[model samples]
Target: MKRLILLLVSLPLLSSCSDQWGWYVVDPTTKTGLTNLKFLLSGLEQTVLMSFTAIAISMVVGLAVALPGMSSSKGWRRFNRVYVEVVRAVPILVLILWVYYGLPQLMGISIGVFGAGVLALALSDSAFQAEIFRAGIQSVNRGQYEAARTLSLNYVDTMRFVILPQAIKRILPALGNQFVYMLKMSSLVSVIGMQELTRKANELVVTEYRPLEIYTILVLEYLVLILAVSGVFRWFESRMQSDER
Candidate 1:
């Protein structure tokens, strides 16, 4: 709060300098680039779409990978270790470039801006989500497995009926946090012309030539988005807590 107050107080001084040659000012809703909010809205929608698709795909992939990774077999465990390490080690920018540019050449097929963006982010997020699932599943008590065994439940039945329910509760918060991270990372998709919020902001900056104010607006927009996500997470947290009681 203090930082926000200081930032708001300083905006006038920072934006009032004589050297603000590249800065341009226009009516917030009447500027050439921002003449219609439709463009911004379209961009924001694309961003949300990309994040949603990516997160959904990542959740599925993470669960699939995590099951094998968490297996007792040495080979599966080793493969999981390498998979997580390699993916997490690579930078998101590099992953984006590979998916957007390299993928078409490799497969002789093209995924458009939206497809490529979702694929890239999902691939990256899967690594993290796999770890989340692994940790969640492992956190279940040994006694839970023993109880399921006493009921003559097989591994699959045990996981579906006994393990996953508890694991899901523990991992809900982490998944929500991952969704927030994925939302911000979707901005990187702009590099391949996905036209998400950041990309629209760039176009606005170029046309209106107001980097400072435009970027500030963009930051505030993202802050709102993050806060909304956090609010939803809090609601889920409350519900989960109530269930636990």
Candidate 2:
């Protein structure tokens, strides 16, 4: 965390060296640079909001999909396999386009840009989330289930009290990775005019005519966001381990 903070703090200072790199476009020392900085940062809120909403939706859908795979019924298991295989095969970009353009036509409904992006991201990510959830749940010891039954616990009680807690603990790291992945994937939505970080950068690039400088800033922005998320998860996993001990 300290390293991340230091890196962010020093980025602006590098521009002070010279304007040879056209870093002046984003140089916080100048008035135009300060203006451009605010413009670029303006999209941060939307990007974070969109990623969180999509991740929440995907979690619910993924758990629903995962539960069936663990069921005794062969039909449910088959449905789970089919759903995961099919969805994971489709490219997210294509899915986003279809949701934006194709779905409204097919369903006679109006799916706006934000809605389409959320749907596409959630659907695309749910497949991977289901696999992680399925693995986590299945990783629980078989004896745990028998022990729960020995305690007069029913299926639902057993899962709620005994199984899911352990499974969630085991899957925390995987879930964190998926969130970081979702954040990066959310940028693809900017292709459809969602005004996310990438979209804002592109718009600024056109007017400022400084793609090199603007995109350098864009990469740094994501690098900081993703690195911070990664650091937080590492801390969380360590905290969970300490609590277990």
Candidate 3:
């Protein structure tokens, strides 16, 4: 226990050496060299925007797919299963490229880099979210459905009021995890020149000729973002547990 505690305590000190902020000789408020900072910060914002937007779309698509996949109808379930399989099998980066570049020529409608990035992320994330919801829905007791029917609830009403509420409670943690995954995956958007955080880091490296510092800063920003998300999820999980109690 003593050795473990010592090692644990030393971990932060070790990490701080790598991320130690250097002296700031440039004017803090000036926009000269700060152009790099501006672009970097904007990239961070773009990452956040992409993730949140994709997650929003994912929620809708995932739930739509989940509902059909969970239905009693054999045809609908099969259809949804095929969709999930196709999406899950395809690589997301390939999908992003196809959407951004290939689809324009084929469909005669061009999507912007950010739009294609969001679409690709949403398509990928929705498959995962669909499975999450499916598992949550299946975990509900059959007796709950029987009870709701006895109370004169229609199928839709029963799902809306009883099944979904309970399923959502059970799945909240998984849902939060998927959101964090989405946030990290948004960094991939830089491939299509969406000017997200990773792209901004690349731009900074080109201008400042400081690959080490720029990449380090990029990593720190993502670490902070992930930590913030984890903290929020922890708080939300605690509140959910309290509500359950």
Candidate 4:
């Protein structure tokens, strides 16, 4: 993985040696390039913040949705099905646009770009998260539920203490993947003027007139961010597996 990252990072530099490429715009050695680089990296904080906030919201909302679907009542199951189906069917870009532009009109309240982006991301991802949680919960051994009932635990207590812990462990990887997905999807919020990584790159491209060079760095930024996130997830998974032993 390190080798792959190094190779990817080096590709643009090698190509930039040609006269056609304007690598000077992002060259770390010069003052202007360093400033431009900093300007681009500035968006990193917003991107990470939005993605994390959205994913966290989606997890909670998804768990709530999943619980209803798990209920014995047909009405609740139908509600879950309708919600998941409708939400998952919508394109995330369209959802973001609607949340940013249209939702405020309906609610009669203003939402900032960051709030709109986060809300849209969370709502769009909640459907998938619901399925992941449901599968993970269902995968828990039936004997575990039986043991909770034998202990005279109520449904809430059984889920909170006995079921959720096991299900969360099973679902960690899926959650991690969703976080990664959220990171990528957050770029779409750029369309609504959320000043994220892609937005920074786009702005720089307009001023520098070097789309190729600027966008190459943008790609690298995402690549590095995603690789780092994946590494963290893998470390957590390993630690959890070791603890299970």
Clashes of each: 0, 0, 0, 0
**Residue-level lDDT tens digits of model 4 in 1-245:** 87967877687677757777778898889999999999999999999999999999999999999999999999999999999999999999999999888999999988999999999999999999999999999999999999999999999999999999889888889989988988999999999999999999999999999998898889889988998999999998888887662
Please give, for residues 72-175, the per-residue lDDT of candidate 1 as tens digits: 89999888888888988888878999998999999999998888999999999999999999999999999999999999999999999999989989998998
Off by over 4 Å in 3: 1-33
Who wins the TM-score comparison? 4
Ranking by TM-score: 4, 2, 1, 3
lDDT of 4: 0.92
| Deviation in Å, model 1, residue 172 alpha carbon | 2.1
lDDT of each: 0.84, 0.90, 0.82, 0.92
Q: What's the CA error at residue 164 for candidate 3, in Å?
A: 1.2
Candidate that would win on lDDT: 4
lDDT of 3 by residue, 1-245 (tens): 36645754564456557765331211246665466566677787789888899999998899889999978899999978998899988887888888888888999988898889999999999998898999999999999999998999997899899999889888988998998888888887788998889988887678767675567667767877887888888887787788783
Q: Would you estimate the TM-scores of all the predictions?
A: 0.88, 0.92, 0.86, 0.95
lDDT of 1 at 81: 86
Q: What pairs collide in candidate 1?
A: none
- What TM-score should be assigned to candidate 1? 0.88
